[model samples]
Target chain A: MVSKLKTSLAALGLSTALATSMVSGAFAAAHETPLTGDLVIFSDMSNPAPRAVMEGMVARFKEMNPDLNIELTIIDREAYKTQIRNFLTANSPDVANWYAGNRMAPYVDAGLFEDISDVWEGDMSENLASTKGALTIDGKQYGVPYTYYQWGVYYRKDIYDQYGLSEPEDWETLKSNCQTLLDNGVKCFTIGTKFLWTAAGWFDYLNMRTNGFDYHMKLTAGEIPWTDEGVKKTFANWRELIDMGAYIDNHTAYSWQEALPFMLNGEAAAYLMGNFAVAPMREGGLTDDQLDYYQFPTITPDTPKGEDAPTDTFHIPSSAKNKENAKAFLKFVTSAENQTLINAGDALGQLPVNAQSSVDDDKFLKEGFDVLSNKAPGGIAQFFDRDAPAEMAKVAMEGFQEFMVRPDNIDRILDRLENARERIYK
Target chain B: MTQATLPDTHADRGKRSFWRRNQIAISPWLFLAPGVIFFLIYVIFPVFQSFQISTLRWDGLGDPEYIGLENYRELWDDPAFYVSLKNNVLWLLLYLLAIPAGLFIALFLNQTVTGIRLYKSLFFFPFVISQVVVGLVFTWFYDPTFGLLNVMLGWFGLGPINVLGDPTYVTYGIIAAGLWPQTAYCMILYLTGLNGVNPEQIEAGRLDNARGWRMLWHIIIPQLKPATFIAFVVTIIGALRSFDLISVMTNGGPFGESRVLSFYMFEVALSEYGFRMGYGAAIAVVLFLIMLIFIAYFLWSMYRETRGR
Candidate 1:
């Protein structure tokens, strides 16, 4: 880290700071120039591993095109969410990191994101085709996905063995597994709903399983009413688990990260969480033999499986000064070789978006990639928050949290959500 | 020679003398300008702007469409709004307990005992710590799984109460956390008030057979009126603007049961899932009005007190 900073600082001093950002004005006078111009990229790869990946990608990109001097600024992830709004309209970087699906709707609608349909055309379409639907708003692709991960019941294989249980293939077996775990004084599931979105994950999988992907999509899209019979049945299924005390006690007090200790300590058997959780669980001393993954089991017969796989993407702001270099940078990012390198197990530990890219030979990564690509025939949801508009997601997720605490308040909660849906959709 | 080139006329003389003539009146304004301008720009204008924005139907990213109080109209039917308002009321009523609590602590500690300064600082410790730190400490203290609170309760075989997680107990739990700092603040105020208490009056009251409750009510209490007034004003304002403890402890959770108006305003406008600037502005406006009522009453009482004097 110290050496990297020294080199960057040395580069600045050698060029009198004119070789990079300051020379952008010079590029404007020429109109058409070499790839030698400045390319500013604002990214939210703030965590240590992702930070290394971002810095590594930049170093590699710089090496390929020695003429280009790219300026990278990494913001803290939480701050980046709000700062993206300000910087997009005012001081835009050439490229920025944002999420996929309806999460980017506001920026897309406000004309902040540059339409990159041309980038996605031809061979590019087939390469990054998996996340194209996620980045597209109103039939126009706005961004390209770098990596994504699957969401499922990440469980302790060791705990299952102790209980003499196998991976559940159906809702009946899933419940019986939960019941056995509960009988042995273990929480069947560990979830933290304090932030409210974790509860939304349960709703997403349950609703998708009970009804179907299309129904779930329409419901989030505000076409299906909250009080619909299908929605009620999903909640009914959820209520059964709640009634059984399957989730950890006082879950509302813990963040998703804080709830990991339950599974780590064997107080809980499993967590219905995103694949990102594997890193922490592994860090908490669970060996590969101890940890395992399974697709959330079926509820209604013949219901096609659906999975939550949120994609993180990069985009060019519409008002960005250096569009040419930005496009080249993005192309480099989505290239098969680069995707494989950046999304490798030692780096992001996530599934690569590029279909042509090689999946890393890690057990969880391979299973996640397989589950997302093949097992989820119904469709891939971007998550409840990303699938629905932000306002509706917040209100609905809060309702989901309330329902978890008070199962009997389901009718009142449905009515409240129904009311919100009318107004939010309007 | 330096003055030789100066214009010598009635108008020139008047111009030169104008600053000198108006210095007393204008100098105060010059001092006040920076503060007043900042106050107007930062505080007063934003309050008015919130009112204007509340009348719109816009997210922060797009052009705010003037929806003519539709935001407020929505808030009228909104259950979350009522929950926030109800919590605000609960905060106001419960937060006032600090005054009496602080007074008692202050009175008890108003002694010349050994290591008295140490004891006073110990009592004043909660106020000195940052609210965020206090909130974090209380969160762990109230943790249902392995918190000190539940462990202590286990000794009595009482409870494993998830104070921050249960709707019935969440708001009160946060309020209790808030009271830790607030009572210290009130204690400090009363401590200072106790310093200026008249020894002669206490002696005179003792001679008149006024002791214990009677002496406190007649002599000591009236003397602490100034401190009491300041404490009342600050505590009320603090209670109305309660956000940090609620935010740090719960983020308005156990299903939005712990949200005060400010936290709700922030949640609706700024939180990741929240983007309805218009709705947030409406919440801000409502919170502002609630604050304005107490401010007006306090200002009116001060005016009446001064007039009577």
Candidate 2:
């Protein structure tokens, strides 16, 4: 109750700061701070809409502070992941886009990111308070959240209706529904484990559901042994589904995009994916009535439904040339107005960071927002890959893919992951 | 003035003539310096650096900590490392098939019926296509659903086999794709070699009542040794560096079953999911050692032949 009151008070304080700053033109950059020189930004907003949004942000920021030269270099999203380490140490950008969880651990531990706790003070802290926890490491905030989206079972609603089935609320019901779909010549799920991270989604939900959120966190953070009883239980649950032949065959051959045709063509009835899948699914010709979502069903029944909502964020590199300009840009990005603009339906189509910013009216956005905000009681995870260290995540996800293909190999896979965890976390 | 100056210049030339004195030996050294320098910097230095890095634990960022033999220790225990080594050996053995297959194709195409030029070019088409494109084409060809291979198998009612997906067949499937272009490359080399064949020897063989296999083996093959040597050398190198097809087709997966040392190195070091520079360098060191053995053998054999001549 006390924490809730503090949050509201922070939000109120933020509202006033945003208003006064906007009206007085102080946010043209930062208050009483004139910006000069180059404000270089390295963004992984390579996808068309996100790229446009990045460009728009730069243009708007430039318009406001004409003295500032903002050089925005947008890189291919996947390529940016590996390149960030190089540039952060060598050719540091003023600002960069990264994820908001333990994905930031390597950078934070290496002291690559600047301590941006001052940016989070007063008005900014309240507005962007929700994701402050995600960007924090060892009691210090390192970055600010720009966007996030939910991961869930995106299913074919029409196929469910055709098979006289409804969204399963439990494991048994889910299996039964899958059995029905299988008996009627449809695979229960269409997954492409070729890149391996797709399989991690299943692990994230299965482990979280079987054990609960805190246990899942411990496992990812390498505190819990991968060969633990809880981990085995999670794999056992996954095995039942695999044994039922519930997934599309040759899934290891397809990427998530390639796997979409199975769901789109109705050979498979559902896909366990992020909100990003909705765009491609819609583009592939599924109607709103045809496509629907459900939170991953409860496995332990009362494990307090934790959710995966991977958040993409912005950070200032500690070695940046333009620190003052970078800080101002970070504040400007998280301002209620900019969050609303960039995360609009026509732009990122994702959840805004600012509590004061309104969410888009799109059905997926609304439901994802509701599930992330109200329905999820356990906690929000930054997905498996983002939550775990990069090396462990890669090894574990490959193990997940192997288990999916050969469920009997669970013992070997777990042992391998346990070995990796010991080496990686140490 | 001209006569006096000429005598003085002649005296100066006596000292400057040190270059002229050593010109025969010095010219080649001077000419070779740039190539030698580039080879040392680009090739030799990096090779040594990889060895140095293999003794450390680096994430390609921050200070790389010296942990002598640690990365190699990890590699020794790594299952993925063993899988890659075994796959590389398998690739080396099967990829050699391209040589005999290329010879057969070259012999078949070494004819002059009408429009044989068009047929020869057609036979040479696979080598002309980029490996990336060939990789893509084969990926689609071997795709599980709606693939031409599966469709044809459907006629035989045999299979809808996912060649690239199944761990059992994945390496073989990729090797087969590699063989297509490699066979073409060898065929082109053999054809060029066949053009330089001594017709006098063929006549001598015919006069000795030698024909077909005997005549070709004794007469033709003996003269094609250089081409055969080149073909064998290239094929081994190609087999060892089998990355592009694996990358484009399966990405060394279906549980990373198709990974060779090079692809595995890229995966652990440079790929989006990977950043273990130390481990990658260790793998690279192993690959380098493997290549070095083959290279040493090639050099020894070449020197022996040259010395014999």
Candidate 3:
């Protein structure tokens, strides 16, 4: 009787399992389509704007070359860095999105990316020149710049005007405006350093203002000592701001979006964020007329300031089978008409790299160009995290947080960063 | 004529013996082949490959240059490695508290009530969700100004503390997040064990005047050993292999204060950090070896138990 019961129970479990699998199998079969081959495109920009651009690109490319097939894989933006690294090593996609900077160094050094300099020269030559030197590793162009935007202090013009404040042209004026804002019971600044990357903008503004272009480049390249006078001065200024109660409290718990509410409620005066933040500003119920941008105040009168925008790019993986088709697709996307379409979407407020590309009619694009065009000749990209290695970026940002919350730990903070830098660079 | 007949019979016997031996030898292998092949390919092969990769300096591409034990040497001096290792130990030690705590909750909820079954499933919900979702929920729960925890604390007139900000409390905070799901897992295991408890044994203990803690120590606790063992096994593995919670919650932050070995390894080998794959592998090897020691202890104890049985 016991044996018979055991057999019956086992039969019951097997049938249930089989029933579930068959149900799911039928669901899967409904979506199945025959394909000769698969190409996967990995990217971090699955936010609506970039996603639409990518989908359109894929559709156009597929239509142009009906014989070729591709699969577009959108990785979460936050997790993309780590996930794509694993994918590239184990099962690389045909083409993938990546940032340009020392960020791309490891992949380039490993030869994970296929060199597409020839493609750029032959087909996309004019588009390549517009990016200047942004996408080059050594002398070769490894990827095509898709879109990029300027970074600056985005503030409420209405609040500034009500307080009789004009956009500050120099450091002293900026500090005074901050004080004025604080005096009015509004937080002078709002920022979220939860990920530690936001602090890079602050460091960039200060370093660019104090040390100028060459030193800024060298500092980011890890060629200069972070403890050097120029770097220290930037930290000292940051400390001054912290001491004045200038920044928002509990920044560690807040993400950039969380900080938005404080600004929207008029509890905060300004947010030093990227151009993409403008869309959210509008989304958060701020009118277009209420928003404005200003260069982070110039610290040194003689320093030349250039645009500190980070650009995104795409490259063919060394393992790609459709190299020729991929290059053609890349070339097609970078064409003036496609780029115009990409930027015209409010979600992607990228400054067109194409000289012929114009957004004279769009106020946001006009605002972006006005700021970027007047930037000092040797404007530097954001420093600290971007300049330092990723490991160092992690350590340095953590140190910045510690320093912010506990100002007395300056010695310990600097020492920790120095040690991390040595260990990583060595 | 008789000698020739004897030779033929001897040859026939030898041929028959050979056939029987060959069949006997191949039958056991045929039975073992599937599982052995799977274990080799999925588990053993990757481990050896990782070990081999750990010995060479490669950036996940290009030619791998042999750098023999330099990675291990670097790990000795790497401070982040130590921080992460220390945190992993903290996670393991503190994570064990889940088992007893889980049992306490399980025992309380073991009673029949109007909605007892629904309550049990609700209690077990944390275990069902992915850790990423759990991390996000706890991150909000621990948010300084707006988090539910702070709102609860506000009734006592305490300032909103940045649970994730302070390096001192960050790891503990993340561990608390981990404990949520881990406790749920243990609770389920204990509930099953409690259901299988012998009622006659309980009645006999009562006749002997045993009850409550005394009864638990002598009878109930001993009976729950199988569930307890499985819980311990899972908790230890989960604690040591913890990456997702740390990654999602802190990214090993407030200054690498929450760095765990697994995350630090990935950061070192591939992320924006240096491509020290060998160094990363050495860190992994250390983690693997630590796990091995625990596994050996578990195996030895199991071996003794099985032999005694």
Candidate 4:
């Protein structure tokens, strides 16, 4: 009697499983287009402005799709960097915030990130043309970039006006400007290399200007050796700036934010920084008119100017439980309207990547859009750390920081970087 | 005492007798089981697992590839590894200075006086605040442009010393910052030890005219051996685990000059650099081995003491 009961119980369990699958299949077939499921997103939108924008977007998405349950988890940026790999493997979220270019390559290579080519083949193909190159690996698109901003020399207009200086257009003029600033008791630049990546802004611009964008990309991609003459020339030009006392004396002690005081006080003339610096500079008591943006002065005049444009993106992890809802969420978030919302949001003063998105009315944003669209050659290269393999980037940034601190050690630093590149890229 | 005073039935007496007969043999293992289980799970298992992981090329996500000793081979030529090892030695040697410094402070505050407790707690202020906060405070203090250290140095026409920037000075600067709290910790340990010193023995020493250095060296120090031993062990462990202050102050910067083994392992495993779990685990294994030497000696000495007792 017990054996007969057990057999009946097994049959009941199998039928229940079959019935649930059939019911879900019927439900899926009924609404083949509209998404209805739990959509979980993990983001490192810790910065207040971006966080607000993301929250707004999520609320709007919920309103649009009443059937979908959206769960948003905002983690601290630094913690997210480590936790992402773990979560992507174990308890993967449907959508996650990450960077584009080489920063996304490792996850893509490990098959941890989903290939969102179908989503890209839809509206994104036309809307996000420029950023597609950054998110593509092995001919498959993996992420959708939402925002990026331009990096250039942010200068004190008041200081430049007082010194009777023009924005340097080429290497020679830049040196002359440095000389004039130095003579007038102003340092040519102020940078905080304490975080290391700030120095990469200088390296990226110099390398791009000296050897052109292709060479810079090749070097960052580990195709060219650091000991190459093109690499050496970049350092040679950087050395001249060091010899001229162009930067703040003890830059290594300050982070990029900490170095802003020198420029605000007119002790230093310019800072090679991204557009995000403008908000902080304004908050530090500089007026809109007092601060002006200029492209990094031309180094090798004829080289295609490659500007640093670090793009932020979102992707679906391969292990996501709600793939359909994740695609819908990605589509909604990257819409031109939502992109414009993010642009106008108070926290993030960055430009949207969408072609049809409304531009921010801010002066710096206008200047950044103009520079990035008109001046940059073959579009923009992601900043150094974002463009290079992470291990190589870490060593390269350290090498740049060391060179800044002690220019005399350039050859040794280059050799050390080459060693790191071999180990990392291998 | 209450249990013994209570009346017992014959069956209860029999049960008590049985427990009394077997308790010596079974009780020790019962008491030790929880601690041993914890040690096996948290400490011992991880050490062996790290060794296993060091032999494989895992990225902490996918299947680990067995790569033999390739990670170690790579570490053999890794300049950063040597730099970290040298810094570790420097940290270990300089970190020992805390024990003496702590003992000095303890001696200074050992006397009875009004409001002495308040003063003692105030002296221990550095230990109370988290190390991360102390690190930030020191970073500001060492800031080249507007730091208090630079301002004071300017008064003497001396320094705009880029303490964190100069590789020659960065490690020392961080060690000094670490020493601030470490010294306070040692001071507390010594103070507790000082309190437990036999007053009658001190009275005997006083009657015999053994005072000051002689009293401290002969009569006092021998009694404080247990505290010294503890202080030595903790300081060594603290020195080996010196990651937070280095991470906060310099981040092994000015060309990776200030990296310690722990920070280097973290950089390899979890930083913006893609995770090289195998390589990082190899580094961890080496650090564990180095630490194991000290641990083995400690356990051996502890065993001898227990055996003698």
Among the numbered candidates, top TM-score falls to 2
Every prediction: chain A TM-score = 0.92, 0.92, 0.86, 0.91
C-alpha lDDT of candidate 4 relative to the true structure? 0.86
Which residue pairs in candidate 1 collide? Answer: none
Q: Write the per-residue lDDT of candidate 1 for residues B101-131, one digit (tens) a residue.
A: 9999999999999999999999999999999
Show where candidate 4 strays beyond 4 Å: A1-34, A345-347, B1-24
Chain B structural similarity (TM-score) per candidate = 0.92, 0.93, 0.91, 0.89
Ten contiguous residues with the weakest lDDT in model 1 chain B: B1-10
Q: For residue B185, what is the lDDT in candidate 2?
A: 93
Worst 10 residues of 1 chain A by lDDT: A21-30
- Candidate closer to the true structure by DockQ (higher is better), 2 or 4: 2
TM-score of 3: 0.85
Tell me the deviation in Å of residue A93 in model 1. Answer: 0.4
Tens digits of lDDT, candidate 2, B20-137:
5576799899999999999999999999999998888887766899999989889889999999999999999999999999999999999989999999999999999989999999
Give residue A292's lDDT in candidate 4 (0 to 100). Answer: 91
DockQ of each: 0.74, 0.72, 0.36, 0.58
Tell me the interface RMSD of model 3, in angstroms. 2.8
The digit string of per-residue lDDT tens for model 1 on A190-219 reads 999999999999999999999999899999
What 10-residue stretch in candidate 3 chain B is worst by lDDT? B12-21
lDDT, candidate 4, A348-386, per-residue tens: 779888766656667888888888777887458999999
lDDT per residue for candidate 2 within A96-141, as digits (tens), equals: 9999998898888888999988888777777776677788898889
In the range B1-309, model 4's lDDT, one tens digit per residue, is 457436544435555676665767989999999999999999999999999999998877767899999999999988889999999999999999999999999999999999999999998999999989999999999988878999999999996899998899999999999999999999999999999999999999999999999999999999999999999999998999899999989888877899999999999987867488999999999999899899999999899989999
Q: Is 3 or 4 the stronger prediction by DockQ?
A: 4
CAPRI classification of candidate 4: medium
Error of 3 at A223 (Å): 1.6
